[model samples]
Target: MAELARIQPSLWFDSDAREAMEYYVSVFPNSHIGSITEYPADSDEKHLSGMAGKILNGQFTLNGVDFVCIDGGPYFTFTEAISFVVLAKDQAELDDYWAKLSHVPEAEQCGWCKDRFGLSWQIIPENMGDLTRTPEQLQVVLGQKKIVIAELEAAGAGI
Candidate 1:
């Protein structure tokens, strides 16, 4: 568990920084976009492309975590190694999230899904940690990869 909030999680984007921010704000509660600064045509780098103030710097609070989104272009990309999970307290919460977040059908699964922007997220039960740390039951299944949640819990429980 985190003691105090200070550092912000950074997200690099190839484009659509503003659009992504707006969609994100709508997805999670108590979240908003801060400031957005774009590049200026005056500079050699600016003439290439990008909004003059599209959102050079902005802040988004999603499910309590402060995440910063950036449009760094081909310079960087997101991978499954990093993901944001929402600990839903009930079936309703989980179902609602699964329905809304999985708007992109290509990204749906057993409680795990991804956003329209290819950002992966897991919508799970709030007390799921208790099940995973059991050290008795075993289950797992990664993303579209080798393993994922079912295996993780079983492993943690030492099944």
Candidate 2:
């Protein structure tokens, strides 16, 4: 076994950790599912009765970033406070991710969107800083649900 990542984001799910992990791996390149530990069937804990056979801990990599997830009962959920940022190389990549991940239209704002599983993601260009260097360019980005690299560049250049 390889050494564990220094910092891995752990996600808690009601009972869909495996599904979520698989979906993520399919969406990203260089990604794969790792070891999955299921809850013991003979556990004495009544509280975990429904969790038997479910994923107690599942590891996966999304574009090389390590993440762990569990099928723990729904005591919590994802929120906008914490979101994954995808620095896309260009508009095509950004649009591809946005098309696949953006499920909640109400949550869309400034390149941030919520996936079907309620996970928030910021799909922005790799050169976002350079594109939004000017106030007009920043405003252009802020007003758009998905970031348009060309628009930002035009705004930055006063076009």
Candidate 3:
């Protein structure tokens, strides 16, 4: 028997669950699509909703973290309050994610940006949590879109 993840984040989409899942898998390596269920055309909810044969629910993994996406109609949308934080191992990794993921320039601040799918993401350096010990170091990163590791280190040392 296969073990299941205890908790997984389910993303609600209007009608693009499959597309989003595929896109995510393509972006992150070592990820693949899991189970997928589609709405039946003859179901009672089909005619009124017009979502027949669309993805009812689907699962995928990003960097080993499981996630689910549902074609749940447009009653709700993604918010910035909930975001995925990508821990970049180096400046190259940080730059790659920032360029590939961020789509809304106006929404970017303090290493946070909204992707084309409206999902919020924080592209942060892997050592950031350790570097921001002092209030001064924290302040240095408050207004920057992409974190500069050298600057953060200097700030932490009061240089």
Computed on alpha carbons, the lDDT of every model, listed in order, comes to: 0.66, 0.91, 0.87
Over 4 Å off, model 2: 1-5, 42-44
lDDT of 3 by residue, 3-74 (tens): 985999999988888988888898888899988999867556644367877788898999899998888888
lDDT of 2 by residue, 33-120 (tens): 9889999885768778767889998999999899999998879999999999998998999999999999999999999999988899
TM-score of each: 0.71, 0.93, 0.88
Better model by TM-score, 2 or 3?
Answer: 2
Rank candidates, lDDT, best first.
2, 3, 1
TM-score, cand. 3:
0.88
lDDT of 1 by residue, 26-116 (tens): 8788888776766554345653465455556667777677888777676777666777888887767777777667655655654567777
> Looking at model 3, which ten-residue stretch has the lowest summed lDDT?
40-49
Q: What is the lDDT of residue 92 in candidate 1?
A: 72
TM-score: which candidate is best?
2
Ranking by TM-score: 2, 3, 1
Worst ten-residue run, lDDT, model 2? 42-51
lDDT of 1: 0.66
